[model samples]
Target: MTDSQDFSNLSNRRRMTALILLTLTVFAIGTAELLPMGLLLPIATETKVSISTTGMLVTGYALGVVIGGPVLSALAGRLPRKTVLSVFLLVFIIGSIVCTAAPSYGLLLAGRVISSLAHGTLFGMIVVTAKNLAQPGKEGKSIALVGSGLTVSVILGAPLGTLLGQHLGWRFPFLVISLLSAAALLGIMKQLPPLPRSKGGSLKGQLRIVSRPDFLLVLLITIFGTGGTFAGFTYITPILERITGFSSDSVTIILLVFGAGSLLGNIAGGSLADKRLVPTLFGGLILLAVSMAVFTWSSHSKAAAVISVFIWGVAAYSIIPALNMLVLNKAGDAQELASTLNISAFNLGNAIGAFIGGLVIDSTLGLAAVPWVASVVTLLGIVLAIWSVILEKNRKCDRLPEYPFENRTA
Candidate 1:
């Protein structure tokens, strides 16, 4: 009996280890996605292109994620999830290698697109894996813990890549991200447990949830809510220099400060969501809108702008984990596809925000106009969140699955 108990204990430990390692892969994916934002200037200089043209890298990557998320997740529906995740990370590694070696802007953009194609699928698989391993009544916190990796990457990866680009050159950042991607691939290969093929039915069954009102509402909330963050952040470096009067060398440090705030926000959002997911989502959206408005006004004052950036980082990120939980809870038994779709929604938000920001900057409105535009969009998101909350409050289910935990671990 003692030996049997010991074996069980060992199994639990191994699963936890695998979860942590998979979370690190989240970090790598997040790093690769955001690093280009900080390195865009150098990339543009090297390619002899305008900054507006360089912005295509971000737009293109986001488009790839939007296209790949649900499609790849559905296509891999019959395969072992662990195998799909491993292959996706390998794709990221290959793409990173191409990015590091690319001789022209066009080639680098292609590499980014290829790498991003794997983003949503990896995150979807990883989140489902995390859920399976979580203790009952703790799904939100568990998934949030894994998702926190992205926030951590923003805090560390973006700034580190920026400094590396400044000192070692732009190509070096991709090389470093490539190494991290390779590490993630090995970890997943060795540690990830096998996930069985879905017994729930075909891809059509999984996609049926997409037509639900809650899912559509949540997706819109994600698109507009997160879009608010990107509209300003896509141009943050320039804003820091042109508006805040910061030197090029100091921008990375400022970003680090923003990242620190995001780390705190991610953890806080997880905790709050575990207690009351709806209220947490509502509060986060409201705070985000208010913060963006202040950021628009504050950008001209260095001290105020720095403070606003920190606040913006916190408010913007605080909604991420909560939003994921909301969608998962709404999807009922079809959690995997819903989870994948949420990641796609986030990336879609990024693309929309970047495009709108570019439009405003290109017009006579200038970069300063981005924050106000973002603020209005965010306020609209707040309305959607409120509607979602009201819809759930009025929901008339005879049974609500006991909050998505009570039976998840099986």
Candidate 2:
């Protein structure tokens, strides 16, 4: 592989172009992973299953990502990142094709799982790829740019796919996804080049990060902090329509507001992350906790719901870039493993947060109580983040440990 410094030699235009393609690649992967959620009803209807059972298709995708991110990254540790990306994109494409033609619900679930296996690991590689190419002081911004694909998928792809499914049947959306992934595959093949991997790291050696209590604490924060977003967000449609008293017809407009907030918040957070990692993260979580509280109150008024959901979107995503940067820093020499593990942490949080919301609904608290439960959970994250920040500050009294990496500015 060429020296990592070769990245710095590329002009700004080329760098931006590469980032755009990577963003689209991630966008495609994200769209496939989430497209199932939008088609749950139609799928359940066609496959002779209950709606709740079809929802498990989403659980299957998240599980695939949780398992695939770290495992796939570890097993492919020896391969060039470019090759890893290529093969995973191919896997995603094949998975989508299978979903398009699946003869049964079981087969459709299998295809979603197959496609999702590429979700986290490929995203891990994409982050490292973008970070490696970034100019000094731009790493957070670049990472956020790549991460924006997921937000865009929620905003554009999933909704459009849902619309297509309603019009042309559920199978058609997967076929569309297959076409999109094929384009991403060609983009990966053409736009990305061979990238170096850690020279001395082994999967077993990388897993040693699990033994470090300090890093594990950080991961815990990542789980709850990011997961807190989903706690309320997982049911935004119902919350807006049912609790906020927005007519069911206004749900799409509210959704667009929320998606717009996510995109803006992601970029704003990334910019802030570049300036100040700890303070920015702390502030983001603080605002996130506040936003959740705001939503709790805002859900009673229609106009308030719109404004609050938009702010909630911004506060929710703003912390991610900094949070992710913290993980990479904590993982030290095992940046790739740590990065992917954060992905797992994220998925785990989503499941747990959703469960928390579900519990609130099942109990006397009811659906209107969802954001209240989520707010308390987010406060826990804020507390943990504060502890981590203070601990890092005290540790600064001693010499910081060495973090290995190839020289990138060469």
Residue 193, model 2: lDDT of: 61
lDDT of 2 by residue, 1-410 (tens): 32347587788887888888899988888887788788888899999999999998999899999988888888887787778888988988888998999999999989988988988888888877888878878888998999899999988989998999999999998998889878878877887766777567677778886548778888889889977888888877788887877777788888889899999999998888887787778888888888888888888998888888899889888988887888877776576778888888988999999988888889998888888779888888888877776676566546563431112210
Q: How do the residues 154-184 of candidate 1 rate in per-residue lDDT, one tens digit apiece? A: 7777778888998999999999889987887
Models 1 onward score TM values of 0.86, 0.95
Candidate that would win on TM-score: 2
- Model 1 misses residue 406 by how many Å? 9.3
Task: Show model 2 residue runs off by greater than 4 Å.
Answer: 1-4, 400-410
